[model samples]
Target: MKKSLFAPIFASALVLGLSACGATAETAEGDTATAVEAAQPAVYADLGGEPTGPVYRMAKADTLAVSGFDVVSYFTGDGVPVEGSEEFTVRYQGYDYRFASEDNAKAFIEDPAKYAPAYGGYCAWAIGANDALAPGDPNVYKIVDGTLYLNFSEDVATRWNKDIPGFIEKADVNYPTHTPDEHYQD
Candidate 1:
C-alpha cells in the first residue's frame, strides 16, 4: 500500500480548522466579540521578597491577590495592571486589595466580586488545563467578558488565549474542587 502525503496534510488541516472553530472570544458580559483582540501582556513586579502575611487564596496562601495590583485598574486604566499602593486598601472576602488611588479602591469596595480575578487569583490556565492550583502571575493576564483572569506566565497567558471561552468554562467548573487545601492533601 502506498502512503499518501495529502492524507497527512488534510488531517492536519482538519485538526487546525476544528481547533479554531472551538475557540471563542467572549466579553466579560458574555457577548462574543467579532474578532478576538490582541492580548496585551500583563505588567507585573516581583513581590516575592515582600513580607508574607495573611493574603487571599482559593487555597490558603500568603500571597496577595493579583500580586497586590489594583484589580480595578485593569478595567479602568489602559488595561494594564497598575501597581497598587498601601494607602488605599479594601479587604473583601478574605482578600486584601490595594489600590493605585482612593477612587479605585472605593469602586472595588462597592462591588468586590466585579473587580476580583477569576479562580481566586490562581492561574487560570493551570486550573483549566490540569485542575491544579498554581500562583497566577500579576503580569500575565487576560480580561475576558469583563472578568480578569491571571495565568502563571506570559506563555501560559498566550496558551489560554487560544481558547478563552473554553478555558474559562473549564476553570469555572474545576475551581470549586481544586483548592489549595485539596491539592495539599494530594
Candidate 2:
C-alpha cells in the first residue's frame, strides 16, 4: 500500500482523530492524557458539543469524512477507493461522506455500516494492539470479512497483516469502549 500524498493536509483537516486518539492514552501512573494536548474536532449532528471520542475521521462538525473518498468504491469495481465528489455527498450517522458518483452515493445510503470502516476509521492495528487512537490512512487499507480497516501508514499496515484476526479480536473489544455513545456499533 502507498502512503497518501496529502497525509499532512488530511491530518490537519481531521485533527479530531488525533485529539481523540491522544485523549485515550493512559500514562504509567494511570492518569489519562487530555484533549487539550491536541486540537479538537468540532462536534456535529447529535453530539451537542460533546467530544466525539473515537468516532470516524471527520472533524465532528466538518463535512469531510473518510478523507473525502467514496466508501462505495472501496467495495466495487477495482476495489480501490476513489476521490468522491462534492456534488455527490451523503450524511450518515453524523458525518458527511462523499461519493464518486450518484450511484455510489446511493449504494452507501442503502447500508452505511456495510461500507463504513471498522474501528471508526481509526488505525485497526493501533486500536487492537494498543487500544490507542492513530490516524488511519485511507490509501493504506485492507478489507477483512467484508469490513474496511485502515492503518496509520504502509509501515503500520505491514505490522497489522501479521495477525489480522487476532488484532481484530482485540479491536472489537477496545473500540466500543472508546467511541462515543451516540455513534452506531457493529
Candidate 3:
C-alpha cells in the first residue's frame, strides 16, 4: 500500500515539472520573434534619395544620425567642408565656400540646396528604412531645404526607393538614440 501511494506522488511531480518546461519554451519563442521584427531593414516606396558612387573620399570619413539618417562629409584641417566645392578656398565642414566674388558664394549659400545633398546630406535609405546611418554617395544626392544628406550605398538606396515615407518613419524611430556621428575624424 505504501509503495502504491508513493508512485502516485512521484508521477504528479513529474507532470508539474514538464508543464513548467513547456511554459518557459513558449516565452522564449515570443521574445525571439520580437527581436527578429526589429532587425528587419526598412524598405522604401520612392527611390529618390539613394546613393550611387562614392560622394567624398578622404583619410577621415565618418557618419552621423539625424532624424533617422546617417550624414557623411569630409573635413579639412580646420573642420571645413572639403568634398563638394570647386573653389580652392571652399570648405565643406563649416559650410563655407569661396567663389571669385563673395556674392557668388553668398548666392550659393542662400540656396545651398542647389549644391547640398538631399535628406540633409545623410544616407536617406539607411535612415529611412531602419533608422540606420551609413556613409553617403554625393553623386546620389539632391538638395532639399538647402541642406545636404547622404546615403549608405547604392544597394540600400535602391531598396529605399520603393518606400521613401515608410523608411523615413522607421529611421525617425531610431535617430534620437543612435551612435556614431557622420564626420568623426579617423
lDDT top scorer:
2
Pick out the ten consecutive residues of candidate 1 with the lowest summed lDDT: 38-47
Q: Which prediction has more favorable lDDT, 2 or 3?
A: 2
In model 3, what is the error at residue 69, expressed in angstroms?
19
Each model's backbone clash number? 3, 0, 36
Q: Which pairs of residues collide in model 1?
A: 27-145, 28-145, 28-146
* TM-score result, candidate 3: 0.39
TM-scores for every candidate against the unseen true structure: 0.64, 0.67, 0.39
Ranking by lDDT: 2, 1, 3
Stretches > 4 Å off in candidate 3:
1-104, 111-115, 118-120, 142-149, 176-186
* Residue 66, model 3, lDDT: 26
Q: Which stretches of model 1 miss by more than 4 angstroms?
A: 1-63, 179-186
Error of 1 at 60 (Å): 5.2
Task: Tell me the tens digit of each residue's lDDT in model 3 across 1-186.
Answer: 466557656655665565555422223345533322332222211113333222222212211112221222321133233332233233333332334334434544444435445433447776666554455665454333334545666677678767766766676565545432233222
Considering summed lDDT, which 10 consecutive residues are worst modelled in model 3? 61-70
RMSD of each: 19.0, 13.7, 22.4
